[model samples]
Structure formats: structure tokens, C-alpha cells
Target: MYVMTLTKSDFEAFKELIKVTLEEQTETFLATKEDIKHLPTKDEFYSKMDEIMGELKATREEVVMFSDLNRKVNDHDERIEKIENNCVILFLFT
Candidate 1:
């Protein structure tokens, strides 16, 4: 084991360091509280969220409609191709 010794001056300097640290931390706590006070109220936040959700729902519906239309277009294209092939076959036979 090792023994260490501190002078009176060393003790006073240690007390000063503790006081400075507590003061800095207290200031930081107060600053954080002040920052939190500036945040949006719960109702305001909820309304903004609602607006965004509404827009997302509308966009989702539009996407579904577009997908259905795309499926119909592909079906129509297949039907037209079949009709064209039948016409060509008839012309060749005649």
C-alpha cells in the first residue's frame, strides 16, 4: 500500500473544484429546462401529425388506384395482341 499527504492549500483547491463543477452542472440543467420549454405543445404536435397522416392516406389511395389501372392496361394489351394475331392468321389463310 502507498500513503499520500495533502496540504491545506490542496484541500482548499479541491473544494473549489467541487464548487465549480456543481455550478457548471446546475447551469447546464437550467439551460436544458429552458430549451424544453420552447418545444411545441402536445396539441400542436398532434394536429401536425394528423395533417401528415391525412396526406399519407390520400397518397396511399392514389397509389392503389394507379396499380389497379396498370393491371387493367396490361389485360387490355393482351386482348388486343390476341385480336391482331387472329386477324393475321385469317388474312394468311385467305
Candidate 2:
């Protein structure tokens, strides 16, 4: 069991409190019109994300190609060194 009493001023104050709370909650859940204009739309965001991903993929492919080329060049350098050493030894003997 509960006993409750409300003066007229108290009731008016409670009403004002409820009104303020509702306004604050509404603002929290919903952005203002100005805020919406500054934000990107969903489609625009996704389009930009897709463009970035494509660029990233292309960059990755280029890195892999350059890495392979570097390895091949290193292998060729080793072979060239071995050939040069063999030539020097043959020349010394002759």
C-alpha cells in the first residue's frame, strides 16, 4: 500500500520535468536537420568504401609483382657472380 499527495505547484513542476525529459530523449535518439545534411548518405559511404577497397587490391597486386621481380633479379645476380668467378679462375689457369 502507498500514500501519495501532490500540490498544484508540485504537479506543474512534474509536468515540466516530464516535458524536458521527453525533449532531451528525442534529441538523443534523433539528429537535427543540420546534422543530417553534413552526414554522408548510406549509398555514398558504400561507394567510397568500394573504391578504396579496389585501390587497395590493386596496390597489393603491384607489391606482389615487384616482390617476385626482386627475387628473380637476385637469382640472376647470384648466377652472374658464379659465372664471373669461373671466368676469373679459367683465365688464371690459362
Candidate 3:
């Protein structure tokens, strides 16, 4: 056996709590809608991607130029080494 009792004041308090909760939920939903409106769209996303790819292309060109410059420096170093070797051989023979 169980006995329960709810007073008029208790019902009023419960109603007030439900009203406040519903109001807060509605406000939260409206705030979320405002946030969604400010989110990036598909066109904006594509523009960002294009900007990144442009930067990447520029970086790739710079890398190719650096690689070519490095190869030239290596070739110059090899030539200098060969000349030094020849000089040493000539000095030893004479």
C-alpha cells in the first residue's frame, strides 16, 4: 500500500518550473538558428578551397626553383673539386 499527496502550492511550483524550462529551450533553439545562419555555405567553402590551392601552386613553383638552384650549386662544387684535384696532381709531378 502507498499514500501520496500533492498540495496546490506544489502544483503551482511545478507549473512555474515547466514554463521557465520551455522558455529557456525556445531561446536556445532561436540562438542556434542565428548561429546556423552565420555558418559557411557551399560557395564560401569552395572559395576557401580555391584560395588554398592557389597558395599551394605558388609554393610548388618556389620549390621547383629552389631545386634547380640546388642542382646548379652541386654542379659548381663538383667542378671546383675536380680543379683542385688536378692542381694537386700537377704540383706533385713538377
C-alpha root-mean-square deviation, each candidate: 3.1, 4.2, 4.7
Ranking by lDDT: 2, 1, 3
* lDDT for position 1 in model 2: 88
Q: After superposition, how far is residue 28 of candidate 1 from its true place, in Å?
A: 2.4
Candidate 3: tens digits of C-alpha lDDT, residues 1-94: 8988999999999999999999999987775656779778999989999999999999999999999999999999999999999999999999
Q: How well does each candidate superpose onto the true structure, as a TM-score? A: 0.73, 0.71, 0.54
Q: Highest TM-score: give the candidate number.
A: 1
Model 2 weakest 10-residue run by lDDT:
31-40
Mark the regions of model 1 whose C-alpha exceeds 4 Å error after superposition: 1-3, 7-12, 32-38
Checking candidate 3 for backbone clashes, the offending pairs are none
Instruction: Compare the candidates by lDDT and give the number of the best one.
Output: 2
Superposed model 3: Cα runs more than 4 Å off: 1-35
lDDT of 1 by residue, 1-94 (tens): 9989999999999999999999999987775656888788999999999999999999999999999999999999999999999999999999
Candidate 2: residue 35 Cα off by (Å): 0.6
